[model samples]
Target: MSVRRPAAEVLQPKSFSFNEKNLLVVDTILSKYPKEKKASALLPLLDLAQRQNANWISTAAMKVISEILSLPLIKVLEVATFYTMFNLKPVGKNLLQVCTTTPCWLRGSDDIVSACKKKLGIDFGETTQDNKFTLLEVECLGACSNAPMVQINDYFYEDLNEDSMIKIIEDIQKGSKPKPGPQSKRTGSEPHNNRVKV
Candidate 1:
């Protein structure tokens, strides 16, 4: 689904150019596509821009991408605006994408959401004052079997309860990286209690 992302003009940077390392990455990505089809590199280019610009794609960045891909500025803006993954505005260092879909809800995702809100003192779509975390309620993240999960950055911490969720936040606050995956005894998506039937 498309998200409501305002331009938030005040936050926009005056200009954006990929650093030397990322410029090399951009070339590598562009080389995969035919010269005539350089437009195909739009997504990765936008991703690289977002990574370079602190996890959000700015209008300036999109313009640079359009120039690089030989695509129109509007074409790049269309893709960036249409995709929910592209954040138009600034986000925190740790984007906490909590899943509240049916599977996770049935597995007590509400409590997980509550834990995040309480622990961070910020509701969904809000960021902490320290810019450490941004709480967002997202759709399923494909870990239904180990539901009640929250994706912190690129890692998924699943099978969470209120207390466990609180602990995770506390660990992050203390500069410790909480281990990802099932928070319970189960390993991966295996059956609970290790009760494997023949």
Candidate 2:
């Protein structure tokens, strides 16, 4: 499948540079690889660039990465475009990645998706007007045991139903950080109804 990148004239930034802190991080990452094998640092550098550039990888940022690693620009672009984790366009502060794999689906992930869309007033692959949330349907986030989950940025909110999902979004909008993990009474992937003794 072809990946769609934003038009350069439309959304690309003029340039990108790592800040002092990230530059130090770059040096540390590069140090882990042999000087001749600097390209191995490409993924981490791209990740750093994305984090520094508001969670999206711009063309200019990719170019900067290529120059830093002494790699061809195409190599950087190929890696960036191939990874779903790399966003080509700007995203909101909270990236809501709903897992809709078979496990999640079986556990009512559809309701979670609907709740997010209605609460955020945006469909999948779209961001809210306030730029606080972007909703996307992703494959399994490896939390099948906690099926029907949504990953908000770096945190996972599992064991969700429609009401809990809506409340989580509302909490974020109100500038409150909802505790991450199972929304239900169960704890940390433990069996429901205390089926297993810990």
TM-scores of the candidates are: 0.93, 0.93
Question: Model 2 reaches what TM-score against the true structure?
Answer: 0.93
Please report the candidate that would top lDDT against the real structure: 2
Model 2 Cα shift for residue 28 (angstroms): 1.1
RMSD (Å) of each candidate, 1 decimal: 3.4, 3.6
- What tens digits encode model 2's per-residue C-alpha lDDT throughout 1-198? 112233453467798889999999999999999999999999999999999988888889998999999999999999998988998888888999999999999999999988988888888877777788888999999999999999998899999999999999999989999999999998888778777655
Superposed by TM-score, candidate 2 places the C-alpha of residue 83 at a distance from the truth, in angstroms, of: 1.6
Lowest summed-lDDT stretch of 10 residues in model 2? 1-10
- Clashing residue pairs for model 1: none
Best by TM-score: 1
Compared with the true structure, what per-residue lDDT tens digits does model 1 show for residues 17-121?
999999999999999999999999999999999988888888889989988988899999899989878888888889899999999999999999988988888
Whole-model lDDT values for every prediction:
0.89, 0.89
The runs of at least 3 residues in candidate 1 whose Cα sits more than 4 Å from the true structure, single-residue gaps closed, are: 1-10
